[model samples]
Target chain A: MAIIEIEGLAKSYRVYQKKEGLRASIRGLFRRQYRTVEAVRGIDLTVEQGEFVAFLGPNGAGKTTTLKLLSGVITPTAGEARVLGHLPWKRENAYRRRFALVMGQKNQLWWDLPAAESFRLHQQIYRIEPSRFERSRDELTSLLGVRHLLSQPVRELSLGERMKMELIAALLHSPDVLFLDEPTIGLDVIAQYNIQSFLRHYQELRKITILLTSHYMKDVAALCRRVVIIAAGRIIYNGSLSGIINRYGGQKVVSLQFIDGRIPADLARFGEVILEEPPRAKIRVDRRVVPEVLSGILAGYSVEDVSVEDPPLEAVIAEIFSRNGEPPEHQVGQIPELLKEE
Target chain B: MSEHPSYLRVLLTFARNSLVRDMTFRGNFLIDAFSSMSWVFMNLGFYVLIFEYTPMLGAGTGWGKYEFFVFLATTLIINSLVQTFFMTNADEFGELIRTGSLDFALLKPIDTQFLVSLNRIEWSSLGNFAVGLLLLAYALGKIDYSPGPAQLVLYPVYVLCGVAILYSLMIALAATSVWLGRNQTLYDFWFYITNFSRYPMEIYRGPFGTPLRRVFTFLIPVLIVVNVPARMLVRPLDPRAPEDFLLPIFAILATIGSLAASRWVFGRALLSYRSASS
Candidate 1:
């Protein structure tokens, strides 16, 4: 069953465009210029139950706006979306009680009070039964390894610890659907790994539907199997993580280690030499001709080891975003010509 | 299925959390309490000095020294309750909008207005409330006229109505922050508007004052907040004056209308909320 269904969902904002300089500022007082920003153009998407999907996009590509629309924080300008069988923008209490939204940049916990106090307040607001609330709170705190920090004031906790507490607060109600926007942003590598590990474990345990938007490729690579890439307010790709690499990443990188530990000056003849050293070298070759290139290299050089692998996912994703100008909408199950050199 | 939490339970939780937050900053809390009490005492002394020369607040106003003190006490009670429960929240509404923290408030499974209005209680402002009660008792004893049981029962009820009126106005003004981006002048505007309610309606009469009284009583309806309640307690309604009988009815209507209007404004503002980019 699909837990979220969005069709032609769009949101636009009218922003006042203030000109630079004193004279423009004075003119703005009388006649201000405004422009319509189409933050989320008409787009369609669906997520199945218990799926961990990554909503990927560049800055201002409508990732956070779409999340806001789905969470009922902001209404859309056009189209419709249903999450958990409820119209998100209607903001019904029943719908709100069933889902939770966590923004990494925002703090929901009381700044001066302990996280326990905020959790207790959430229990009251969500009307969770005391026993159930206690069980959920204890389990979440233990799972996040922040039980010791529960009594300390939120402001006193480290950023990573505070984020863990925020997650616990969000999950205490046992929401069926969770929307996460940049949850791993600005965290250290270890902190990111901790959060990613916890999310993966918890999702596996509960089988709850989650739509996470994150800039960290490591987070996407670790937790989400499915990915949706949006640019210019339109989704240009949506499929498996490997599928994105396979479709847009048409070249494979071949690394070779020479037994002689001597560099071949003419190695560039085979393909683009990405890296060259005395003992090792790497070359980028078209995927279809990788075998030919590898055979040619082996025939000339004293190669001890050779490996062929797809380009890094991060590189492929960056290429896609760089070419996302006026992106052609991508429909599910239909491959489109994307990332072609203009 | 989980039951919906009682609103009272949520309010109590907010109050508890607020108290803990205030206790975290003990020095600031103590200073705020002291300053609030000092302001109230200063205002009381100023009024006492004025009453030494004139027996009544205004000519033919029927508000003598003790009656006017009751009016002052009523103002303090209503204003203190508003400040304690809502002043800080209303002031912070613009900040929440600017910082996008209001998103959390809207996400909760409770009424947004209730959460925004009662999330913080300024324990310091309760000092004025205590002082108001003491002043009311002392003033009533000094006056020769005694209030009946009906008058006593209506006083507190009307006081609540007064608080509701002011809260509605404040919230409505705060909601405009959604469009304005920042409403820094909300406190100043509230002070200028509520300043009128601090005085007796009897004083707003004659050539220059009559128009102002009509405007405040009928249009803004702030005059009825303190005037109706104070009059019902200290000054009995005149049997011959039809306007006196109509004042209580108008007070109830004003409370309901202000609340409904503010609720509508808040709802509309929520729709316009851009929810600053995260």
Candidate 2:
């Protein structure tokens, strides 16, 4: 059975639309107007035990809302969701013991206490055995490399260091499922990598089900093979990472900065000019015309630096956002054309 | 394993943590301790001034000015003890709910009320308890009567009952966070309760005082905890129903209902908790 089973799960909040003014404020006390924000429209998904999944979406796309619903932090307006055969909204202590949610912007560690003290409180809360608690604490502290920072108050630690301590505090109970909303957000590249590698190693060793929502594409790309994309309170895309790329990302970008040539003046015939300066710059022709565009740009200018890479993820998502019915094609070069037309 | 932690364990842990957290700011602790001790002496001022114009409490009530001081002091004791522990950081729940911090608490495997209420420790209330005890001893010496072992036993019981009633009242007040939005004035509700409970109940004992008396007799139970304990220090124990213990006991029961209502309101509020953000 799936560790997490969400079927047509939906959530809506009666959000207040405040009218600003002294008179309006008093009037609002008697007659308040509220609009329902359908943050999570019906979303149906199932995660088999131990599946590492990425939940991807833009701001207000309901990724955090969905995670909140699954974690039982808030109520679902409609439908059903079950984790470990328990409704999250019921929020039983037993159910809570089996799961953990770590939000990057919010912290669980007590600011004025040492990280270890917070861990001890969590241990009591979870009723973890003393030996088991120590073992887990030592292992996580060492893994996150925050072992040395255990005695210092959480407020004294750097953001990166505090984040590591929070991880150890969160995982001490050894929950079956991990819910992370922007877990690696705002961390430096090295810190981000450290967190990512620890998550991967732990998941492989423990086979704990992991669900992550992050702005960093690399976190999803590096850790999750399956992706669930939400937009406008609905699941717009749910499939493999390759499926998202293949569906939205098309036309490889071939950017070359020629050392001594102006691309727009010299290489207009070769392909679309993306940027031109002391050297030339251009978006490559489609893959079918890769050889032609490459040879043409080389023939047309003195190219000193060049890089060929996939179109950026945000553009593909933009295309996804704007497109309806059929997914957009691999018209990667269409972006430069779309830009030129605009 | 026990369902909840043992009471001794809970007290020791809470007290230890309260001391440590307060000791970190040594200057603040000293200032707070000074203010709390001075409040007891200030409370006696009202008694001394009132009795200068009158000999006793009304006509038949023979309680002297020092005895009145004892009553006020004990009331303060009940209040500060309850406030010492029951005064929760959860009073900030409306903001926490708005900002998504409550989710961090909710996701933990613990009772949300217990966790939020006990998360922070305030040490200044201990000074109030100490000062109030000193005043009670001095007043007992000034008065003709002395409390026996039963009264000593009854003291802690009444205090516990008082603490329970106060906690329930505060929980009901704080639970309004869900519906009232961010600025739920828990202190306002507390002040209203304290106004009635702090005064001696005999001051308003009559047919017309039914609804008014019920405010402490049953409504919030502030009268039972403060009055019964102070009454113990004065006069011999009556044979049939001594020192109006029924009201305090009833207050404890009412508090149980209050806690249940709080949890229900809190659960409902969580449904609408937007997790406040900038």
Can you tell me the CAPRI class of model 2? acceptable
Across A1-342, the per-residue lDDT of candidate 2 in tens digits comes to: 699999888877787778989999899889989998888888889998888999987778789988888888888888999999999988887788888888888898878777887787777777778899999999998888989999888889988899888888788989899999898889999999999999999999999999999989889889998998887777777889887756556556777876656555645565555655556365645556778777776676677887777666666666665543232233333433222311
Q: Largest DockQ belongs to which candidate? A: 1
Candidate 1's C-alpha lDDT?
0.90
Native contacts kept, each candidate: 0.74, 0.41
Choose the strongest candidate by lDDT: 1
lDDT (C-alpha) at residue B144 in model 2: 68
Which residue ranges in model 1 land beyond 4 Å of their true spot? A328-342, B236-240
Please write out the lDDT profile of model 1 over residues B113-158, one tens digit for every residue: 9999998999889989999999999999998889999989999999
In model 2, what are the clashing residue pairs, if there are any? A250-A332, B98-B275, B98-B276, B99-B275, B99-B276
On residues A94-193, what C-alpha lDDT tens digit does candidate 1 reach at each position? 9999999999999999999999999999999999989999999999988889999999999999999999999999999999999999987889999899
Interface RMSD of 2: 3.1
lDDT of 2 at B132: 80
